[model samples]
Target: MKPIKNVCVVGLGTLGTQIAIQAAAYGYNVDAYDPKPDAFATMQTKVKAAMQMTRKGPTFPMALWDAHAAKVRLHSSLAAALLTADLVVEVVPEDVESKRKVFAELDRLAPIDALLATNSSSIPISRIESVTTRPEKCLNIHFYQPAVGMNMADIMGGSKTSPETLQAARVFVRSLGCVPLMVQKETLGFCFNSIWRAVKRQSLYMWDGGFVDFRDIDRAWMTFTGMTYGPFFLMDLVGLDIIYAIENIYFESSQDPRDAPPASLKQKIARGELGVKAGIGFYKYPDPECTREGFLLGA
Candidate 1:
């Protein structure tokens, strides 16, 4: 509430690292933490890359670098990170049980008034809130991948999330140069994932029915909608395993058949064909050439 001088990012994965770097760039003293010590090095590398990227833009603010180096600190211990945190954002993997464990620990370790937020893509804020004693301060601050590039964010409130807490989160997110849309009620997939699942269902149906190949599907969206990447490409960028996990959670939470990830995806996941990160998915990416394999069906 007091302008969030010091913040803690609880998980230093891809999303968490981006969020922490962005916050630091905004002049907030940041304490970044992960259970793994190797994560510290990974996060630092990411921050350096992000800083270089920002420097290339004409509109980039130079003040961010000075504040970032002076204000941000990385830690491997949860206690060390949460000790002086005024706001704590949890970006752990999208497992409800895992989130519950993190939230329980945060509630115990962080200050009582610290604004606790989750960056979950699909998991409900209500479920996360249930694990914490101070549910009134628990909320969701969903940021898209590459948080520095994406300006849109969602501020989702659980049943127990207080108005004051929501307002604080909105202000904080805005300070990071992001647009925050407040979701009045908490839902299983929130806004983005729900809409994404619907789109994915249709795409998977086409793929499974042999109606279209991956290239055609991607081209259709890019050509017509003017999107930077098509569904398949975006899925690959997001990591096939992560996409599968979200769909599985959506199916479990809503019991909706449409939310179920198709057999093709399950089979690929089972075979360890996890997309760009894993070097294979809808399309193959050879090491030297990076050539695409699938052809456009209707082109």
Candidate 2:
């Protein structure tokens, strides 16, 4: 429960990198690790770019970059990163087996007293804890996308997760200026994803029913909800592959037809038309000079 000084973020993907950056910004010594050399290199470059921008005044992307570059140490080796870490956060992929493998290795590498956490959105904390010896310290610390900006976080406890462990996680999340919602019972998808699944089901139903097109559905939702973007638009930004993966998880775990993604989504995934990152999805981004309309089909 004491203040976490040295933090290790295992998995330097999009979410892990963001979490490490946030921890560094809060003055915590952060060591970010990933197996891939290229990923580590990318994070190091990104952190340096962010720091340079921070030194400069607010200038569009530079301001944004500086905001991200505050406190991060990039590492390629798990052993090296965890040697000095008081807390270890596993932000690997959502697959249960993959998470178990990471947790097992972390258990072997990290200090005995080091608090271990997972950034998994849907996988149950109990399942993850079952793989590690330190079940009392293993828990879920789900951060929303743009973890640095999202103030809301979900802290889920397995059956063996100690109360002190939960308290420590709450304190750590608060230190980062984020609100931690304590979940006593760990469930698949937890709170956010459970709500999101419902919303996704309803949206897909409407789309499949021929009641609306993608654009109309997006416009209606944005106009009524005051959100920056509609569900489809957000999905596009999140990548169609990820959306498919999450939906597949939900469907497999719950056996709920509602959680099943539509055929159109399946087709998109099959075609490798992943969203913004890949330049095409429900919409497209032909080039930097292209207009939004140009990204739409038959515009």
Candidate 3:
């Protein structure tokens, strides 16, 4: 309800850190809380690598990113971080209960009028909103990897989300230099994420069914789209463990056997193959095969 000048980000994981950085880049005062001791340090290392590897894309320059990344305040306690927040975004894991716990805590700590949002890629705020008293003030402000040039956000509301809240959120997204993709109706996966989910599902199905090699699939996608990375490569960046969790969410929602995650994927996660963070997933990090010039040509 206020001007949304100060933003509090709970859970400084991958996207959490990026959101904080993007907000700060636009001159918004940002405070974040994460139990992980090295969350801020890890975010710096991860974002620096991402900027270096990404030769193109993302409108902001390196200096801007550096300047803001340095200013994002990371705090040990959620209460301290939420003290002056006009907006509080929960970026915890994808699980519903985890989100509910965070949302309840955020509701208790954040200012009465401060907007509470979830960066959950799939789970709607509706499912998680009731935990807090102000359902009208709670909404889903899902973000893609903004640091990588996917500079757009899905702005979806719960059953009780107010129109004023929605407009303010759109303005907030724009303030961060991102397009607000307002979802007209409630959906499991918001806008581009739903489409991406389909691609991911089919890609995994084909790979798991032994119908085609994953590498060949990536090549096909890269060649067709003329993009730097393909589905598998992008999935690796999204993290294999995260992909598995998202897939399981779909499977649980539909109760469809075909939607279930493959056993091999589980095995990979069990071995700590979490993608770029773990240094090995679909491919090794620091120099994934997909980043090589010869990848498209099958070299």
Candidate 4:
């Protein structure tokens, strides 16, 4: 209802931290919360890395990075973070019950008029809105990782979500200089996510089915698309564990065997091969071959 001057970001993981930084970079007062105190310690370092990476993409007002970074306020408690927030963005794990629990808590703790949103990749907002009394103000404001490079987000509403809420969300997304892809009705994976999901599914199948070597597939894809990363490299960036979880969600919803995550991914998880964070996944991190310059040109 009120101008969204203050934003509360719950969860300080990869995407969560970036959202908070991006909001702050745009001069919004950001209150970031995470249950783990240790996460708070790394905020500065992570923010620096994200800024460095985003600079490689689009041209922006680079001077604002420092001024905006100063606007972020960290807290360990949800109530403290939501105290002055006009909107709250939840970026927790993609588990249904976990999201419901966070939504319930947010509804109870945040200001009555503060709109609640989730950054979930696949789970629809309606499934989360049922746990709160303010369903009309709850929606999905899904953001792509490395929020700076992909300056677009999926904005979807639950069945009971109000039109006013949706417009307010659009306004909020625009405030961060990000485009909002509106979904008129509830949908899994929103827009780009649905397309990406298909690519991820096919990529996993190709690797697991022994149809082609992963590196060759990536090489051919880069040569064709002239992109920096292929499906496997993107998977590594998105995190293998997260990919597995997203696949499981699709499988559970459709009960289609084809949607089930590949057994190889599960094995990777068992061995703690998360992704760049663990320094190993589809490719070694910090210096993944696909990320090298001239990769698409056969470097």
Candidate 3 versus the native: TM-score? Answer: 0.97
lDDT of 1 by residue, 1-299 (tens): 56689999988876787777778877788998888877755654544543342222111354554455445587868999999889999999888899999999999999887889999888878887887889889998988754335555688898888899999998998888877777877776666666776777788779877998766777787668765457786676566888888888878877878768888899999999887656678866432111222323332
lDDT of 3 by residue, 71-109 (tens): 889898889999999999899888889999989999998
Clashes of each: 0, 1, 0, 0
TM-scores, all candidates, are: 0.85, 0.84, 0.97, 0.92
Candidate scoring better on lDDT of 2 and 3: 3
Candidates' C-alpha lDDT? 0.75, 0.72, 0.88, 0.82
Candidate 2 backbone collisions, by pair: 24-71
User: Candidate 2: lDDT of 23?
Assistant: 75
Better of 2 and 4 by TM-score: 4
Evaluation by lDDT, superior candidate among 1 and 4: 4
CA deviation > 4 Å runs, candidate 2: 40-70, 286-299
Per-residue lDDT over 19-123 for candidate 4, one digit per residue giving the tens place of the 0 to 100 score: 887888777889988998767446446445434532343224656655565577989788999998899999998898999999999999999999999999889
User: What ordering of candidates by TM-score runs from best to worst?
Assistant: 3, 4, 1, 2
